[model samples]
Target: MSDVSTRVDIALLGIRGGSTPVHRRSGAGPSDDGHVLIGGFGAALPIRSDSPYSLAGNKLLLDGADIGMEIEPIGRPKFYDLQTADGVSYEKIAKLHGSNVLATTVVQTCIRYGEDERCRFCSIEASLAAGSTIAVKRPDQLAEVAEAAVRLDGVTQLVMTTGTSAAKDRGARHLARCVRAVKAVVPQLPIQVQCEPPGDLATISELREAGADAIGIHVESLDDDVRRQWMPGKATVPMSEYRAAWAEAVRVFGRNQVSTYLLVGLGEDPDELASGAAELIDMGVYPFVVPFRPLGGTLAVDVDHASAPNRDVLEDVTRRVAKELQHAGMLGSDQRAGCAACGACSVLSSAGG
Candidate 1:
């Protein structure tokens, strides 16, 4: 359980399942993954039909040999079986992540999701086009589904993200509304809201005021060149702006309550990416570092054929970043809600980040 090399290997290489497993196909933040617990911690491993890694009973095998690791695939949540009063499926509103986190994309389409401008790593609208999720999830629908998830599946927190919008708020206002509505029903539920830096910094305060426990203003890579190449549209928002937003978010949500994603691979220098993560830790933002999975339909996979980072590179950066987080006393578990709290997507939690 202490050694997470196997966990990291499975995360990127994926696991071939003997039968259909608890997995998500697209849109969701940790999409294209099979939800499972490896040594009692939630993990999202890609579900690959041809992966050398596979599960047999409680044992994990790599090329038909047990690797001395155990896994338990998370079950499909009960809320997924219900429907809202208006007849939209509950799952279309929200879906279970890890074991007990309900996650949803409030807006399924983004203004920047167009081919040339799209973030190469994102498939935020693929689910919408496939009819798996609604384009816009109403406050009432989220509230109903959240209630069911918490009641029937023991969901402890909610992670809500929205595709970028054309409005000045850039989708923060609707997120605040969603958080407020969910809180009205599940009064004690911890909620995390993710969005681009709003045009108005004041909107950050509004989200905190609306009962959000934590926030993630994700900038996938700190290297501007990488930003431009990987997230052409997001790079248009200057790093100064991201710093401003992170500072304001920390001011409002407090230390360790604000987080961002720093993706491994995408051609970033590993040392510099780790240094950038240290800077985020100094700014009171948790950098959720993860290896890039070549998920189907993402521009990285279909258009460019990008693969996962080299295993040594991933472990090296993870260790370096985890050390800085330890020195600064920033652990993902300290965040009340969102990807950080779940710690399923990154190996940092296992490294004590």
Candidate 2:
């Protein structure tokens, strides 16, 4: 049998998403949140009972063979059932990512949502449109939710990502304010903030000062041509700006404390993506390589079912990048907080990153 991590990666890339899911959580998916937990790993795997993979008696079964892994749906957090003093549902204020990370989009509306400018893979506002979350989560509200998530559900860390705003700070200022609020309430909780690079690189320091333990400045694809094709508005920022922000973030957050998301199945060359990840490792950035799972309401949804990279492609890139991470002595687990720390969305940890 193949190693568990490799098989899990293959299942995620090619599983039939249209089948009934035994459990579901929210972000984007065939089901609400579209996320599940398997062997301490969090993934947005397609829930298909009839496919070669299925949940049976608490074990993940593959082609009638016991994969020797136990997988279960992450139950909704208790905080989700509560409401703020202002009457907002806790879920609207924030949602649990993976099992223990409290995650929210500080600002749901992005300046680039305009038809010609939006990233094809993102539906950040779809949850807002579906009435599952609010456009802007207030600092106090987030603080309240974070406190509850920790007290009620044992949430250990928090992730706050925002849609790009028109401000020169690119929403980092707002993220800083929210981080302060949450930290004031939960001083010991590690936190990560994600956003596009601010026009003023100095704001990176402000984010760190505001109590963010780690940061993620995501450049989904390093290829300029791919960026132009998939994220027209974001691509306008230029790789130079991304490089500056990453350098500043590393200086502030320290090595392995800053990370980025590198999505596969986006028509980028597998080797090129791996090489880019190696470069990021050299810069002290953890490259979070994940399979592109198309959620409903994004431009890519139409192609998601057919466009998911084959298993060979996913494993090749993942193992290669994992090697680069190892050589650099960068492990996602060292991040202390953020997506790389949670690692439900990627298989690097399973590969020994």
Candidate 3:
């Protein structure tokens, strides 16, 4: 544990922080660990005035000077070049997330995206604003993209998430249909569906019956105050509701297959965060603790909000929760699909699982 702490500190010191042109330029390059280092200039290069973009000439160093892990780039997926029969691009329907998961936002618009209710940390519509995807992805369109991604990119799994629709089921109905459509083509592909707790508990079973291998009902933070502040609209649903939804999801998806996102830097006490994570573990849910990176164009970025939990906080919480998970025999690999299965964005998987 002490060694892990020291390594985290070294990594933190090397973090350049913020999304300036230079900082963004120095952004994540792939590492041999099967995940990209979230921050730091990819490799050290001299600041040449003539060619700012070139980092190739510089020597790669880690912990500011000592050599550490080598950085690589995530290769582009082969499906990028393919188009559906109707002329819609495969990349427009479902794109590669991390290294192997094909992910899509079934509906590009969210009910909470209005000024008053948007998650302060989310840039959910930024990709849409940039014309990176269409507004609503049809079932057929998703099926087409999934088939191509699998055949061309060697994509091993699928993730379907949606912005909260106005309907009571919060878009689970559409997600179920999308899952069914994709399964028709790729019958054995593992699929994970993410959404808010739906109005009807039956929707949980609906997703499983539709061929979803896993589900993520992300309660970004367990603390009520943090939720109210960071996710004002989503917080209206209440924690009790999230708890009930998670219970039903576990019953349907089976234990470790259900997961949630636990954002660590949201001002919650470390003990409280760990306690909540422990509770989720007891309930057979994998709590994915991700550092809050201020994505471009979110309200959080407007206020210059940053992740509060440093590497120490992240390591402490992860170590404690991981111990409990191990005691329960709940390794992340036990999960059939989703972000927890990919295990790239969070270091908890590296800590133990």
Candidate 4:
């Protein structure tokens, strides 16, 4: 195997081994403050499930150790038990993320899925496979879920991300419709929408006009080689296309309101990742630096993939980027909605937001 792949595999094995219950402990102390800490990383664990070996474990590791920060997981929303008139569970439609953001995948299945084009890091269909959610959520269902998550869970924002559809718009139209429906119910709620850069840039205006508060057009990696290896199908779309889409998103969403995901440990050099982040920030976008987690059932898991940049690397990159964001006066607080604002999945929010 190549050097980068070998490094990533080792990292993945370490993470899996470290997350075992025997090796885990609650990060309890005066500093705990309801947050869970593991392996020098800290984040709020979900109140509903105390099992420390799941995604929450990985999140805590990334937060406390990687970013030198602490974040609290979002508690169970009151809407989890509620069902729509048609008998759809609200929680399955849209679940709360972080402290006050409701997130959902409108279309669980992607056209690129099962094809060689699938992004290796993604397990968009796994939730569906485990029966955690329905294959597709109707616009009305999402609006209903959002309303309850806000009223009961104290959710203040919403994030709608969709699997790619057959259309070139890549399900942006459905996302726009969902955003509109949810906003109609809660006009003051901040809503963020995420999707691939569509074949038509006009869909961006459609989303903004539909009342979305912000947008995330994630190009997980700017390094073409890493992109091809990590997200084969998505990498087919040129970086120039992503740049144009980001420019238009910033134009519509305004400054930091536009964001993208930049996963560390994808074989991209640390300096290169930081420099790419700088370019994105310079363009009025937030580069959300996240440590790659190999979700169950993803191609990553099948290949036993892992992230190479450890906590030290993550901290260095986040600190530098946070400093840049501060200089630009672009706190995640300035964002109306989305992961950057929730700040739970990544420690960058705690680093400086």
Candidate 5:
């Protein structure tokens, strides 16, 4: 076996950098300490005190020995130092993701965050609770912060996700409002709008018409059992709704422009997960396969003591899904903008998926 540890290998095993300057201490689902750029691309790795991999002055190390890859941590953006006209910090509005994408939760509070109803792996409101973010980000606030982020940090894209709202649009209409405001200020910046499917399918078209370049209708897992177990509240939305949303999103945003998250550590069988990813690819949806990292404030960590997936399984599924993406000519980089395009939280891009 090669001693030069693969980037994905390091990502799975994680790194012991207790002093990491740019770690995200709290956030929503998917990942935290989210931006470690290896080979000039973003990677999501855990911050473990006992990890085999460590970062030493931009050099990657395995078991205290230096490897050749240059892994750079994305620092706090310049815009974070500034505040809005009403005196809210710019960071509370949106945060830097990867090297070039600005990300935020437009509506930080979730209707599904009740103890019995919440997604086991989510902590969408943790940042809000910690006073690092606001309950709602207004359209003007988003536009102002976006313009500054791009002008100051050279950000190339924006990703806006919202907690599921009680309303019929499920926050899509609000996403459109924020998107339109940002587009009015920065027409050249590609924007990706993410939300649960609305009760009305027409809002999918409204998002595209509002200057959104891409959309992520994330269902996380296609397996109904997995959905039911991991996402009790969201699972109630029915697979039929997700299917309708994906179809409508594909119709509106076009192929390779639509994506979804498929977490590898959710206990879905590796072969089966890849099989599901292949199906998504066939349907013109990019399956973003990322390993689940346990985060503070999530039920998985606080209640179940869930560790990340077995690394072998993570790698196996990634390669399998990447092959399918290759066969379909659907590269994450092909998308105009979104999680797939930034690809910090998933290994699919590293696997060349």
Candidate 6:
């Protein structure tokens, strides 16, 4: 299949999850990275199989018809079986995302988890309730687990994301500590840290100094009205704050090193989303456009608003944003670390962005 068609297929798979898909039994959650190697590229896609597609052996079937493609789900890594010296399981602390990237929710609880304040699509705390992950992961524990992952799994990078803490730094401080500890143990491992835009832009520099190679200051949406509807609490931060944070992060982490997630399936207009992506590219921020999966624990799933965007809508928005990325010479692969670089959750890379 061509790149556009492949991207379209991937987008559809995310919307309508395939059945009997290959994946490891033990990995990250409440939102796990269901890695499936698709097409001939061995491109690892992070899928949440909640939709109508399925697999028969290696062939991918969409709505029971052959997709005319082969896919293989990634198996759980050996490192998950190991435990820390203190007896905490490695898998509880962090899990492999995609094929080789170790990822963790450094702090699983968010301040905005309340009904009126929470992002409708977020499942950060749900994993904790499910006993799939711990509430707080110490810096030292993260360092220890990361070393094991690198040594045992040949893991190339790290993604450390945290829910918004009560502190004004929005958990950047804790993320920095975790990054420092991990970098100290494995100096060559590239690390990506994710958090909300800090109240003090200076924290961006602190994260860089602490050894984070890339940063994800995810806004999820650029349309303020949509933000208010889907993320009432986060929307209060305002677009200006996000812009300032992006500018500061770009200044500290350098051009393509800063990325943000712009979820496409929300109610944002396609033209507006694409335009926002263009503006983000101009600011040296990579807009990681992702299909909005209706995770089971999210408010969207409960309200019956979890439908994925139409195929045409997904493809149009992605192609437009990909064009912007290409024109700006901002390939997601250039990040070297983080969600944008992973390319499993989004098809912009396949679209030649």
Model 4 clashing residue pairs (backbone): 40-65, 41-64, 41-65, 42-64, 44-71, 44-72, 44-73
> Which candidate tops lDDT?
1
lDDT tens digits, residue span 1-353, model 4: 33223222223233222222211121100011123233333242322222222334334332224332222333345788899998888877876554566778888888877758888777777667767788988988988888887788787888888888989898999999999999889888999999999889999999999999999999989899999888888888899999999999999899999999898867788899989988999999999887675444566657756533575676677777878888888887789988787665465755674
Model 1: per-residue lDDT, tens digit, 157-206?
Answer: 99999999999999999999999999999989999999999999999999
187 in model 4: Cα distance from truth in Å? 0.6
- What is the per-residue lDDT of model 5 for residues 1-353, given as tens digits with 9 covering 90 to 100? 23222756766667787645555667775666647787788776678777787878888787888867788887778999999989999988998887899998999998999988899889888888889899999999999999999999999999999998999998899999999999999999999988998999999999999999999988888888888888999999998998889888998899999998988888887778889889889989999887887776899899988887887888788888988999999999999999999988877887787
Q: What is the Cα-based TM-score of model 2?
A: 0.92
Pairs that collide in candidate 2 are: 25-33, 26-33, 27-33, 42-344
Q: What is the C-alpha lDDT of each candidate?
A: 0.90, 0.80, 0.73, 0.71, 0.86, 0.81
Highest-TM-score candidate: 1
* TM-score, candidate number 6: 0.92
Residue-wise lDDT of candidate 3 within 1-353, one digit each (tens)? 34345334333333332211211121111111122322321221112232212122122243245243334334567888888888878777776765567878898789998878988877667667767677889999998888888888788899888889999999999999999999999998999999999999999999999999999999899999999998999999999999999999999899999999998777889999999999999999999876665443677767755633577787888788888889989987778988788765566666674
Name the lDDT value of residue 114 in candidate 1: 89
| C-alpha lDDT of residue 113 in model 6 | 91
Ranking by TM-score: 1, 5, 2, 6, 3, 4
TM-score of each: 0.98, 0.92, 0.85, 0.81, 0.97, 0.92
Among residues 3 or more apart in sequence or in different chains, the pairs in candidate 5 whose N, CA or C atoms overlap within 3 Å are none
Q: Give me the displacement of residue 27 in model 4, in angstroms.
A: 26
Which ranges in model 5 have alpha carbons more than 4 Å from their true place?
1-5
Residue 191 in candidate 2, Cα distance off native in Å: 0.7
User: How do the residues 1-353 of candidate 6 rate in per-residue lDDT, one tens digit apiece?
Assistant: 56576556655554245432333332222253356666533344435555455667777766788867777766668888999888889998997777778888899898999999988888787778878788999999999999999998899899999989999998999999999999999999999999899999999999999999999999999998989999999999988999999999999999999999998888888998999899899999999988776565678887755776777888888889999999999999899799888777787877887
